[model samples]
Target: MSYSEAREMFADWGVDTEAALDKLAGIAISVHCWQGDDVRGFETRAGASGGGIQATGNHPGRARTPDELRADLEFAYGMIPGRHRLNLHAFYLDTDETPDRDEIELGHFTPWIDWATAQGIGLDFNPTFFAHPKADDNLTLSHPDQGIRDFWIEHGRRCREIADGMAAAQGGEVVNNIWVPDGSKDNPVDRMGARRRLEASLDAILSPDYPRERVLDAVESKLFGIGVEAMTVGSHEFYLGYAIRKGAALCLDMGHFHPTENVADKLSAVALSVPDILLHVSRPMRWDSDHVILLDDSIRAMAQEVIFAELTDRVRIGLDFFDATISRTAAWVIGVRNMQKALLEALLSPQAQLKQAEAALDFTTRMILTEEIKGLPHAAVWDEFCARQDRPTGLALQSRLEGYQASVASRG
Candidate 1:
């Protein structure tokens, strides 16, 4: 079917295909760099990833160097339909020096800024809170020992410094995200003490004044983790209160919550209180699986709420998943394209009429219309979007991904 016909069909449902396309085009999905190497960073002294995080699979052609990862990302970016941001971990530094986490300097990431500048994209950053020796007993920022806590605080400060540097070079706010694995496997007798230490540590890290335009500091929370099966010091409540009280952005990872819980449903509630929040879009088989995102019902619901609340500017969307089972480039391409597709579908929904129906207490009609709109010609609109972006639509990019895997990824 012609795109014009699909647009007309959508218009009948009070959906603006043009506006949807425009909005989708403007939404920048933050592509994660870890997928290219199964969360392995190109550090001078890289080690195993700890902090209750692990990427499974022995996929060959994993990018083993900074240049190789950049090449893979460049190829992945070409297949994606929009200009997007890249998310980087502190471990991905391109320095010859083996700087400790607290000693990491801006020079370490100068290469990243250069690459981002050339690509015309911005970069988000995260502190490497795990896999370090100082992270003894699965705690860093919240470690009971004062010296240990100080080390992590310095690391956080340095991360903010690097983020600010990147922003100065790239001309946008670099989101400096901090996620820690500070908890106990068994129920802790002194939960309050641990949380108190965590709060103090965070206060210290964020005490220094940095340009808000240059960097936006955020903290992520996890419900539970591998070793910290019983208690997570940085729980949802902890980060939620911290974000609101401290005036920082909170990161909501889709796979971080319980299997039955819907991170999408929490959007409005969080938006109602928090000024701005970041989203770590991912898929979970049962827990925090970090499966690559797809255009699934959960994703659709989240996008719907974002549009419904008119919180596009307030919400920063980013992809946060890594799978070593598939071609890294293909993983990036699929996750990003699916994210865009979900947002596009959300924009194409008959939101105005649905709201009116709900206000009028017409639940039956609302339900019927909701199910019916699912069958809309969204695919046609998406194809037109791909064409407009000068990208191959649908499965047309399959051969390209395969060819890149053989020709490019094989070299890694």
Candidate 2:
């Protein structure tokens, strides 16, 4: 069906397709930089991927240098239809000097800020807490050794400063998220002590003064991972309380939660307490193995939750996954387009009527409406969005990606 027809059909249900498209266009998804290079940043001369993290597949054309990564990112962003943000880890800094995490300064990321200025897109930052020598035992901020903990604390401090610089460079707030793989492979006897140390370390890292308008601080948690299967230092429960108390943004990584737990359900719960939250959208297969996102039920539900809670302003959407099995550019395009499609689906839904049905306890009507709305012409609206944004729609994007891989990526 034509887009106009679909828009008219949606209008019958009190959903303005144009308005939905406009709203979706404004919401920026923070695209992860690690996806282009399989997380192999040139920060440290580090070894293999460790700390309960692994990227499967050895897809060729991985970004080896900063220029290559930036080129690949631009290629990926061209297919995506929105004013999206770029997410960078501290390890992704472009520099000849392999400075330690604590030693990193804004000068190291000056090129990145300059790039962002040229691209006209904002930037996001993350403190790299894994795959470093300090994380040898999977304990960083919560380490028993004061020196190790101090190193990570300093890293966080520098990360915040860099985030402020990025914000100033782009004239937007940089969401600085901290995700540490600090835990024990075997159940430790000092759980309380570790958490106490972590809390104290976080307090110290966040103690430094910075412009609140420039940077937003967030802490991410994990259920468990390869070495830290027995215990994780920053569980969701731990960060929830900490975020509530410290007034920091809580990062809800979809893959970090258990399989049975719906990350969507926690959105409203976290929104009610925290001032704002960061969403790390990634697909997981039985574990926190970061896979590319798709237009699946899980992602759809998460998008619906965002719409239902009216969290367009309170929640910042970010992509988090690296699948090297396919073309890195295709992976980025597919994941981000799927996320945009899901958000479009939620935006085009008959939310007010559904809410009214639920309020009146009209279970039968609500169920019928919910099922009925699924068959609406969301695809038409989505294609229209792509067309409006001047990006290839559907199968057209695939061939473009293949062409890119054949011409640009394969040579790289």
Candidate 3:
């Protein structure tokens, strides 16, 4: 279908316009947009002795009023609803002051848990305590804040304390999505000990204290620069395979693997290694790591080929993307669209033809790709969205999308 016609049909289905664009390309996404300090109202505060509304002397940091926080939560829900989920990354709090356990509970973290419970929105908890850049001399699991061993131990202790406590008190589960940003120079000789340190860290975090059933150690991969930082778990199959052997499942980030990595193959490998697995969906761009864009037509086609080849009911899709300005709600919409498109594309392909081609792979030594020209029924849902793209369809999808993106300083 043409873009405009496809967009029109998508609007009719009640899908957000941006979401339609994302889905057309293929993928499932859960948008990560922080409710920044600005919107939370970090301006002046009531002074001591009731003097007046004066700024705090020491920059008390921005605090979201209950109303503001609630509104943002509602706004996010309205956009993505269910299917797409939200992950509370440590960075989003927008604070350098390490939050105490209680403050962490009170801030967006607690409210988010409460909100998710009420809204039935799935929430993933990321407990990444140590920063990796400082480990320049040697591959260390320790944070600069604490001794290498001490930091690793303390982080696991805290994670267990928080996770166990919440799982018992809260009704829903919390996923301890672990993505350690660690590594050092590319010298294979010096890097020999890095994986061991990483495994040690995971061993502590994934212990019985943490809810293994609910927790997902999403070993995120990063593009390691220089020689100090080793790339994330994305490139190291052995690291992830070991995690599977240790009883903790795998967490795959779509963007972590670059031009050379195949997401479908990664997914299949993880699935075969472990009984249960979780996934993070994002677009990988050659220009950068974590570009957080959609697949576009070509990538989408490739993703479809992958899913058709290896996807199983055991694997679950999560919308994981970083959007600075896009509202949480809009991000959710885009994610859902991407996921639906990916799956639909897979389901609609010529499976029989694909299977036949696979059989011939042994003799022909060529890859077979199944394709179809039929547009999905859901394409019609975008009519209202298309109408509103240039004008107003009584829904401010564009304005809201742009507004959220602007808030995060995200361009395109």
Best by lDDT: 2
| Tens digit of per-residue lDDT, candidate 3, span 1-412 | 5555655554543434454344433332334433323221321223212101012122221224444444555554454422345565543443334553223332434655566567655656555433322233433452233356455455555654555454554554556666554544453553435566666666775665445555545555444433334343223574566656776556666655556666666655566667555666666554123333463653465456445645544454564553433344454455555555455545444455556667766434223232223454434333333344342222575676556545534311
lDDT of each: 0.89, 0.90, 0.47
lDDT (10s digit) by residue, model 2, range 1-412 = 9999999999999999989999998989999999988887876555634577677888778888899989989998899999889999998888778788889999998888898889987999999998787787888999999999999999999999889988877887999998899999997998999999999999999988677788999999899988888999999999999999989999999999999999999999889899989999999877687889989999999999998889989999999999888899999999999999999999999998999999999989999999999999999999999898899976798789998887654644
TM-score of each candidate? 0.98, 0.98, 0.66
Q: After superposition, how far is residue 86 of candidate 2 from its true place, in Å?
A: 0.5
- Expressed as tens digits, the lDDT of each residue in 1-412 for candidate 1 is 9999999999999888999988888888889999998887865444534777788887777998899989999999999988999999998999888888899999999988899899988899999988777774898888988999999999999999888989988888998898999999998899999999999999999988787778888889998998899999999999999999988988999988999998988988998778789999999887999998888898888888888889899888988888988888899999999888888888999988899999999999899999999899889998999898788865679988888888764554
lDDT of 2 at 11: 99
The residue ranges of model 2 lying beyond 4 angstroms of the native Cα positions read: 46-49, 409-412
Clashing pairs in 2: none
TM-score of 1: 0.98
Flag regions of model 3 displaced more than 4 Å: 1-30, 33-70, 91-108, 130-146, 186-189, 209-212, 223-235, 295-312, 323-332, 350-353, 356-369, 374-378, 381-396, 399-412
RMSD to true structure for each model, in Å: 1.3, 1.2, 9.2
